[model samples]
Target: MSAFSRFTPLIRALPSTVPFVGPEAIERQRNLPVKARIGANESGFGPAPSVLAAIRARAGETWKYNDPENHDLKQALAVHLGIRADNIAIGEGIDSLLGLIVRLVIDPGSVVVTSFGAYPTFNFHANGFGCRLATVPYAGDREDLNALLDAVKREDATLVYFANPDNPMGSWWEADDIVAFTRALPETCLMILDEAYCETGPASAMPSMQALIEQPNVIRTRTFSKAYGLAGSRVGYAIGTPGTVQAFDKIRHHFGMNRIGMVAAQAALADQAYLHAVVGKIKKARERIAAIAADNGLLALPSATNFVAIDCGGDGVRARAVVDGLMQHGVFIRMPGVAPLNRCIRISVGPEHDLDLLAEALPQVLKAL
Candidate 1:
């Protein structure tokens, strides 16, 4: 029963862990069905009908491997963003792309700077590469840009990960502030501006593509998962200088993009009207979530993302109880893992029926506590 002993030192040294325990896993472990699946920040509004039609139309072509160059998707994105196709690199999702970014820049013992409790998956990628993490605590529930810069300079870090309309807590900074932060960083430090939630945030919160597209040390990542409702497709792309993005071509899996997923993304991109409509729905859902929190006397923090973080007015313990109690009623949700931030429970925007489930279960959960 002995296992093979030839794994790399880094692999052997690392503990087995997933960045997030998915809802399906929670359901299996707790032996409860999830009635309202809104925990993982997924778009419960679903993709556009055109996107579904595109998938169905292309399902017959599933046997063919996707184009390694990702030509059509890149071209479509280029036209949409008013950028060149060469400036883009496509991946399965932001998560997979983060791993690639880490591999490209990090060596054993290299320093990686990030906000404490920012995105755990980025940390997972950094740890897998044997990079030492330098974390800065959040300032006023937002990622402290000034402190993050200081950490990068202090540690001489090689890579830094930041998210706009950040996850878990759902906070964000104005676009000008972000551009200023990017300009202030050491050119030696690569910055991953994870904009996975960009489409759902305010226009002022996103820097124009022309602002940082030419910055060699900066890579902006966006996904079809949120506003576009294509999480299952796993399609995401990075925007960077042509020279910087081309590096991905050297090491990326040639056919990692799936045919159906590519089709879904392309269709989703073409249907801007559908996207705008969904964004409106997402806004309403966020309001409903906040209203639910208010009804129970909890403070709902302002969010630029698809989820709302409701302050449970207690520490992680009380927040965790509400999470567990809601789950007991088949209403699945999540919360931050660190202190202060853990005082709030994070809930993703879903359809009215799902939010209704959350609304009904939340007060009952809090009452029980």
Candidate 2:
């Protein structure tokens, strides 16, 4: 039987594929089980015990639809961040929020600027919206802010994505520079500031909520996935002006949030001490990862995020070999997808056992390569 053929041209042109492959999928495809599970930037330290209790207590509410407005979560996050609840919008995660933001601002043929090899999900969302992408190369493993601003000006971009304490490379810019970048962007372009790793970065690396709150063109995204250890809960929020936030109400799935997920996020926010503890653990785990890299003669880049991107002392081929070999040993880790950066492999912060596994596998993998 023939398939229906009336889909939009954009849908037809987009390739059918899941861009970020999960560890579970790799396990199934490669007929191997993941032992360490440190590849996806997930916190193996897990969520706070209070959050787990909250989830368990709320599990019976699974049949209930979550509040479409996500009132409770937003109130909690607002208090946590000392921002007005009106300035926030909740989503399944930063990943979902990025898609909605792209859809909101981008039109077909509009230009979107981002760092080359910064975050694939942002690029994926831009492509899904049929927006033309203008990419700038990274400077010294960090997203080149000046270059990104230059590209946005050159292209007259309608949308731009910036990730401070960026992923894959795990590099970051200070708050002052980020504030300057946001101020420098023309009022004509909407900027998506993805700060999913805010929990793991330096306190000074995150700009004050009030700093960019007045700028309707800027939206800073944050998630519970990193130090909060709630990746599966899928709770993230964006901070912007009320006018900008109200736009999400127009198109977001009103009742899409899961009740248990909301409960988890609220509980997660309430436990500030736990968050601080996890951030400390993440810092320690990062040091362990860097030590493992040094043991193998690889150089780990200084990271402000939860993951460390290590220079494998060779080209992409060597980095890839180490990545593949580690996976073969049930030590799942990832590498950057582009050149220069691709010469490095990224390892997410996890428990001592996971890092122990990576420490064990990394040396053997490097020696074999």
Candidate 3:
């Protein structure tokens, strides 16, 4: 079974791993159907009717490859954000864009800075590119802004990944603080400000587009995957100065975006009213998730995203047991991957019936535990 072995040394040295073990894989491995299906932070509220209509309307165009330039989506985003089309770079999702960003700046052994337990996809991309990762531990369940800045300076890191309304913990800093952080970063160091959950967070937590759009060193990434209910579609974009974003054009896959997905994202952006309605539903679901945690005598950490991290009142072992117990009842959920943070099981907000399944299963899981 031996085959050609001319792969790069970095590729040969890497272990094969998925950043997140998806719920589908869990179902196949455990032989259990997922009743709630809220483990991966997808919007159970679903996309706007308008978005679906757009998809249906454009399904006939599936044979055509999406514009390599991503012109329509970029133009729509430009009008929406009040920025020029040149200021935006489109990608399949923030995950895809992270890889491209790494390729743009990181050489083998180049240092990349990030939070210790933040989003894992960015970390996966950094590793894939053979960059060294410098991680800063969370300070009080939030990314330590000061420590991240310090690490970037000390290492003169090639790239830094930071998430606003961060995942796993669902914590965030105010927009003003984020602006200050961006201002303090050295121009030579590139910063990726991931705002995937921005639509679900407080308005005060999101920095205005004008604040950092002009900074060539800063790239703010947002996605349709969260509040807009388009996780499967995988449409996201990066905002930065013209010179900065144009870098993507050099190496990006021409015509990489899906036609239907592009249509879905464009429709999602145009229907602001629908977006607001879905956001309201998401807010209520977050509250219900928190309430379910409270009912089980666990503390639901303060959340600014579509999910809540409920402290299970014990160590990783206890939290893991609860997660396993719930899955046994077809109530799929997740927990953080690292210590301290793994004490909490992360639950994505779903419709009432999904929460109903959770509400029914959680107590029994705890009682058994």
Output the worst ten-in-a-row residue range by lDDT, candidate 1.
249-258
**What's the lDDT of the predicted structure labeled candidate 3?**
0.93
Highest-lDDT candidate:
1
For model 1, the local distance difference test gives 0.94
Q: Write the per-residue lDDT of candidate 1 for residues 1-369, one digit (tens) a residue.
A: 697989999999999898999999999999999999999899999999999998998899999999999999999999999999999999999998999999999999999999888899999999999999999999999999999999999999999999998987899999999999999999999999999999999999999999998799999999998899999999999999999999998889988998999999999999999999999999999999999999999999999999999999999999999999999999999999899899999999999999999999988999999
| Cα TM-score per model | 0.99, 0.99, 0.99
Give lDDT tens digits, candidate 3, residues 1-369.
795789899998888888899888899999999999899999998999999998998899999999899999999999999999999999999999999999999999999999987888888899999999999999999999999999999999989999999998999999999999999999999999999999999999999999998889999999999999999998999999999999999999888998999999999999999989888998899899999899889999999999999999889999999999999999889998887899999999999999999999999999998
Tens-place lDDT digits, model 2, residues 260-301: 988998998999999999999999999999988888887999
Higher-ranked by lDDT: 1 or 3: 1
User: How displaced is residue 217 in candidate 2, in Å?
Assistant: 0.7
What's the CA error at residue 131 for candidate 1, in Å? 0.3
lDDT for 115 in candidate 1 is: 87
Which ten residues in a row are the worst by lDDT in model 2?
360-369
Q: Candidate 2, 259: how far from true, in Å?
A: 0.7
